[model samples]
Target chain A: MDLEDTLLMMPGPVPVAPRVLRAMSKPMINHRGAEFSAMYDDCCEILADVFQTKNDIFIISGSGSAGMEAAVGCTVGKDDVVVTLENGKFGERFKKIADRYGKVNPLENEWGYSFDLAEVEKKLEEGAKAVTLVHNETSAGIQNPAKEIGKLAKKHDALFIMDGVTTLGGDDVKVDEWGVDIAIVGSQKCLAAPPGLSMVSVSERAFEAMDEKGELPYYLDLKAYKKSGDKSQTPYTPAVPLFFGLQEALHIVKEEGMPARINRHATCAEAVRAAVAAMGIEMLPQLDEFSQYSNTVSAMKAPEGVTGNDIKKDMLARGITIAGGQDRLSGKIFRIGSMGNVQPKDIMLTIQELEVVLKKRGVISGLGAGVEAASEVLDSLL
Target chain B: MDLEDTLLMMPGPVPVAPRVLRAMSKPMINHRGAEFSAMYDDCCEILADVFQTKNDIFIISGSGSAGMEAAVGCTVGKDDVVVTLENGKFGERFKKIADRYGKVNPLENEWGYSFDLAEVEKKLEEGAKAVTLVHNETSAGIQNPAKEIGKLAKKHDALFIMDGVTTLGGDDVKVDEWGVDIAIVGSQKCLAAPPGLSMVSVSERAFEAMDEKGELPYYLDLKAYKKSGDKSQTPYTPAVPLFFGLQEALHIVKEEGMPARINRHATCAEAVRAAVAAMGIEMLPQLDEFSQYSNTVSAMKAPEGVTGNDIKKDMLARGITIAGGQDRLSGKIFRIGSMGNVQPKDIMLTIQELEVVLKKRGVISGLGAGVEAASEVLDSLL
Candidate 1:
């Protein structure tokens, strides 16, 4: 199969812009050279702007998970008490990382639910030094209240760390204003760059904490990374070409103003959610007040006699790639992403494809109903 | 400056093959898709063949350092004893990583010297559970006695780990025969792919150790990665485009037989070394027996009155890029790479450019001397 021609409707590894792809095709350059340093400087500056932080930002040549590890390792040392808000898979991953190094107080919530700030505040009152949360839970299509959680963390004098993997470019993440001590972003999610590079912004409080406790390991040590970034270089050999692509991707993000980018994702989410609702499917997270527009990769109830895997397999046959729920929801829900470079037409086509796939699998679906519903929503927005 | 036109003569982040660049330009795909799984499976099989092992191979969406951390985290636990042969910057990095989770017995050597296998044996005999060494130390232009050290580790019952970052595709590495329980490779160096993905192979013995002590942290945990790779996927989102490029690059490596590829690198190395010698310059590592012909890079001494930085800057002015020595030898030596898809013409042009740069910087007698020397060597062989 020609994967290049197939449309990626998944949450991440989203469709990259042609310009970004062309930019990445440029030949590699010396990472320490003047030209590359200029590129690196520009990337750091623009990434800080995107993250809305004046604190030092370091680019790690790893995935979002690596960024999480770096965040956990650099901030909380061995035997530290960490309170993790686990509303979804990504949040639980933070607890897993914390469990590796120290004691973890997992503030568990339902899979399709988000954390209540009051509950988190209660956990923080129990003497936790750090609190971790995810901005967007890709697994469950839920967006947590990070700003509220940050406030709670501040009230308790705990370090607030956020995994902004799927939310950075498509959402507003004011690290300083939100009192986030460490904010991590992956290149592939909303930035429309291929995944490899991860950016983290560390607050002065976190830096001081790292200085106080010097037990952190070498590679993930935030102090060493910060020192190296002062020279526009990483402590190790970075993924140079990916850095180039990121520079171009960040440029595109800036060109499309941040508010407009977020609105675009919101529009896409609204169109998808409206169509799914019109098709008589229930949204997993029923709390509209807590619903975020960063793009809802909504989980729908499978039709009679049809499984989520059945719909996913049929969608794949029709040249569309959607995601199935992970962990407990794996066989129950289907996920379609409307973030990054995805256009209204892409969404419309996806809905149409979904209708066909559902019908082909002998599930109950009206012919052309999904497309009509999505188009009506798009027309009203346009 | 047009980075695309400038030849990459540096040790890594080298110019990728046109085919590899084109492959990377392919559109992003869902990491969980069957097509992606197929590509991942193919790449892993080719990587295992290249390492000459029957062990399971994994490709992480990160740089060489990420692979190194995974290797260290997987093999050694907290308070485990690890002996590292520190000869250059990368070896020091190994010591740093070892110090993170375990006690390290560092057998330190000079910056430009190869490790003494007898000394490594002595250290391992002093109760180290594992021995870490760089197969080819790029910073010093030295290839350690991996075969001898592997035998020593077997006699001492220590897990043998080698960093094959710069040597995997350009040189012969028999992982099983060399008693290397774990071997790591990066995409940019000799694999001819862009820098992002790192590959690691684990022997059955390493797997057994991991099975016994399965408490590694997430992200760098081998057990998590191994479980995911059983279905041909990573535990987290991967850099999809880079994997596409790596799949193509691995196919090219297999198309050209491993021995033939190693011989090609040897031929290029001999020609580069001959040209440098004729210019009355010394190589960093003087012992010929310890020399490795992974033409990926060759370290040479700076001429009298001309620092390695001076030569590198001059080359950059002429749109060529040769790397200066890293860490302690930063201004003392330079390195030239002729591996990957670099052809004879590229070597000849680099030689011509080097002669001009050297003469312009007042380091050599004649402008055409180095080119003539290189051409004579090529004529003798070809």
Candidate 2:
């Protein structure tokens, strides 16, 4: 049960970098003190670099979903028209959030499918004030066409917001280039930190939207948070130690170089997909053109007569923690993540273990078949 | 900069218990996994015992303020009247949160003072749907009469919500006996865990109100959370590691026994207060009849020539971190907290350090004077 004894292979709450863990264990400081302010300023500055924006960056002391709530709460008003592209669980969640505040125009897609830019553009042309999409859908292991969607939002004068919970550090999320007005990321995903702090970068347009909205419930109000950040503090006491951990994680990301890191993730993801395909299991989204290269995770349909839960349970007994499909696809699809400091060797080990578990659970697959395919993929990349 | 090398003396993010730290450092598990569900269920059960309630208990993966928002969001609808008792900074925050949703009727009191029940009763009599108050106003080191306020809310047939951020584990909060409908506690405060998760126990009556008002924004909607808890999960992914840590911290609390823990806090608070009185520095809330005995923090005025910030800076330089006055009382008062595994030895060490620092800053009339007074107080307790 101890963290030191286990290797987490789940999409998030992945193994934190040792440096980040050490940073989190540092002495607690007063959030309003000058020392903490200095750290806070440096943290935000580096975060802006990671986010690729000049927009204000604020850290909410909560999970990724809290960041989503803050984004929707700050932008959408009682009667606002919000278009949310739903490709997976998290995207559907954005629609639910929009439903809470305003009218939701869902650009719905099947689970394990990517959004069609043309259809989304049609929805935007029909009059939506804002559009929300998930950059990477961890649940279905699909990455939507965020850049195209962002361009479409601009075409119709709609604010573009994206949930980058599982893709921020591992994928190419150039907020400025993508024309994303708001982008949200969490610490526990590709950041390789624990699951507590959520980072949000907001552009000028989102700030103006907040300005036009007079009353927001205090805790989630972007304006109040922005004003407080001017003094390098949160309006309320924050999760101070979590930021210490994040500072170290961001440092690691910077030192590694973002593009190289993203490429590494892409490589790892390709290896995972190659192994899964070798097992004769189909990738959830069959179109190679629509495949996302984020190293975080790969989704595959549970082969006929095999449920995702059965694979998950079998993997668990072998100390591997793969995720089952979420929402509508639960029990039908299986997901394997290789992001967050996971190297090729780790992925190979996982594939080896997975093959063993599958065979032990009565699958007649050859043990080395998956590993050989994954090795070929790795060799090709090298 | 290393955690083990430093002492955390601020009220919250106070030094986490070693056991809790180890627990938090454990490997991450799927939030919906059987192992995590077991931990979650145990934590909730223990939390209910700590709050003295059989009602449903849930944890939000955010800071205490997020819990405050949840309480306010779930119980009140648009245009509902919420009466807040404002004596210090936290009380004012309650007013701000209530104002975000609907009408907020604030029964204002001077800073560094306790609530006047007579005034609260008057406001409640005027037809409010809910009343909010901070059980422990850490800013001013004043604890309000939660039991009395709970009576008023019940009399008016209104939901009674109390913020026990700094009070819950250190003080006696009899939720059932006090008729408190909604009570919130944070992990970092008296619970001796890091700041990430917040625990809330809702009464059947509060659920009734939420059921009647279905307009709550998604994340903060307690009804959605309540429904999810039935499955031993959250509507959104949770901070699983923090929740694991909380389970460990709550276990320690249960093993120690609630009354014993409360008495320990009381004893520590009394020793600190007695020493402060002997130093000839005035306590902020001077009325003996209105004083509360929560063990977490003690608030007092700065001596004639010494500003609170100066005293705090001096303490910080000596490796102690007593807080300066907040809000309106800034630079006029200081606070010292004694809760969560802090002992008399810590109190004595702090007093000795404070005496030296005070004399060095020329703020005290005599050298070793404050230490001697604190020693005498400790001797009397023994």
Candidate 3:
């Protein structure tokens, strides 16, 4: 099937903006030439502004997982003790990558739960070289306490590495203020670009830590990336078309302004939550005393009458795409993303259609109630 | 520094077809959905036809180096002996990547030189776990002895891995016949698709060999790719739009027919060499006893009076983007790529322009001679 009439609302591979899509049609150029070098440097500057950091930014020609691999593989050397927080699938993935190159002290928590600061601090006190944390766990729709964890790791003299895959651009991420030594984001997330590239911002401290270690995997090695970044080049040929899309997407981010973009995501997320709650549905990782709800993608618990798969299937049939829970959470929760250029009108339509599906599945008794509630939230925002 | 009205004659990141460029502007879709799965499977079938193999094909979401890493990292275990043939930059890169995971016995040869079969057989006879060879060395414009080297590795019971980055689509590559266990090709080369994704074909024997080893890195792991290939998926999110372009590019390849495509590349190479020879310029490698010229890119030695950099600067100033030599070849020679959608007319214009530039630089006595020679070669092909 072609990609003509479908609406992509998954956590990633999000629906790209029209202009950004058009940007990918640009002609190819020499990757090592001045034209590409200029584009590369422009992307780094734009991404720096978006990440709210003065740190060094590298554009890697891989998905978000490759960026995560770089964060783990480059800084954590062999036999080095590293602390990793695993509260969701991506968190566990960080631990897995770190385990490949170093001694990992995995601090496991419940899937829908956020990290416990006390536990993290205690683990850090055991003298780890680096700490890996997920800023926003998309699976559970929880924004973990990266700020506190970053501070703890800083005090412990450990480099703070973060997976900002789903939250960096759609939400507020203060890389420098949060004491994050390394932060990674994907092209298709809140940036509204096509997938294939990952933007990584590395702090000076992180570079120093990496320099102390031996070379990591060739393609995933951040040191090689840094060496090439000094001249606005990558060690290998990058995805040229994706770079064009990302540059245009970053320009759009600048035009809308990061603050307004983050606010829009927050408003859309609130409308979604209000609409879903009106249908008597529960959200996963129901906000606790510590963790906050994710403002990019909302994860809802499947109703008692049907599985998450059923709702996803019905949505797909209607030309809309939402995501079912991953791994153990599969069939338990469905996620609706509000990241990137998802407008209020799109959210209203999604909620309306979601309500129709819920009623068709005999989960909700009333129709239009979810839409009405969402419209109220939308009206307040306007 | 805009990408418009400029010629790209580099080894890769070559000029793309309009249809392939437009295809990249298609809207995004769910990566895990049936639509993407179908597109992925279709791409694999088409790529298998291009690779001339019935082996399992996996589409990776990184550059060609990632595919190379997957080939080396998956099959070569720790302490395993991996014999790598180094004749150019990419060959040296393979050695570096293999050295990361296994015991590498590098058979270093001069750049622009083909592998000595006696030397390769001698190394393979020493009982290695794998042997890495580049099918076409782009940096030196030499097509190496991959077929003979592959047989040597097979005879020694060693897995044969090859870097087919620059030759897969533009030249004839028989993976099974050449005894290549794992072959890698990039999207931006002869496929006429933009860079970002790399396609890999793995033999059953390579799969068995990889199974005997431990897990490779997550993103570059071929096992995960194989598992996902069963359902036409990737372990991580792929570059969605790039895949769209690749599918269309593969369709173009089918329409043109592989034999015609290979012949077109060969004719273009012959015309380039004939034209340069008429202009009194020498080519790199100069035809060794066993090695042949590459059909995709032509490497020309700098004339007596100027360096490769001078020629590159003059061409760039004229809005014609040719490439200077890479690494050690820098300022020593220049490259002219005839791969992808670059047509006979483009080559004709490039040769004509080259003569003008040479005459203006006082490196040649007359104009139009190069184009005259190229036209003769083109007419002979017709």
| lDDT leaderboard ranking | 3, 1, 2
What are the lDDT scores of the predictions, listed in order?
Answer: 0.82, 0.81, 0.89
Q: Write the per-residue lDDT of candidate 1 for residues B1-382, one digit (tens) a residue.
A: 4536888888787788778877777778877777789998999888888899988899987778878888887778776899988878889989988888789889998876766666777898789878998888888877777888889999999999899998998888889899899899989888888887889998889988887667775777787889999999888878877887888888889998788888777777778888888788888974546445345678998998889999888887888888898878989999998777666778899988888888777768787667777777666435
Quantify how close model 3 is to the true structure by its C-alpha RMSD in Å. Answer: 1.6
For residues A172-262, what per-residue lDDT tens digits would candidate 3 score against the true structure?
Answer: 9999999999999999999999899998999988888877886678898888988999998999889999999999999999899999999
lDDT of 2 at A329: 93
- The local lDDT score (0 to 100) that residue B15 gets in candidate 1 is 81
Can you write out model 3's per-residue Cα lDDT over B1-382, one digit (the tens) per residue?
A: 6449788877888888889999999889888888799999899988888899999999998899999998998888878999999888999999999998999999998788767788888888888999999888899888887777877887899999999999999899999999899999999989888898899999999989888887678789888888888988999989998999999999999899899999998889889999999998988874556679999999999998788999989988887888888889999998898898768888998898888889988999988889988998877546
Error of model 3, residue A138, in angstroms: 0.5
Clashes of 2: 2
- Candidate 3 regions with alpha-carbon error over 4 angstroms: A1-3, B1-3
Report the alpha-carbon TM-score of model 3 versus the true structure.
0.97
Tens digits of per-residue lDDT for model 1, A182-286:
999989888889877889999999998888767785557788888888998887777776887788999999898888888778778888888777776666763
The positional error of residue A160 in candidate 1, measured at the CA in angstroms, is: 0.7
Name the 10 consecutive residues with the lowest summed lDDT in model 2 chain A.
Answer: A286-295
TM-score-best of 1 and 3: 3
State model 3's lDDT: 0.89
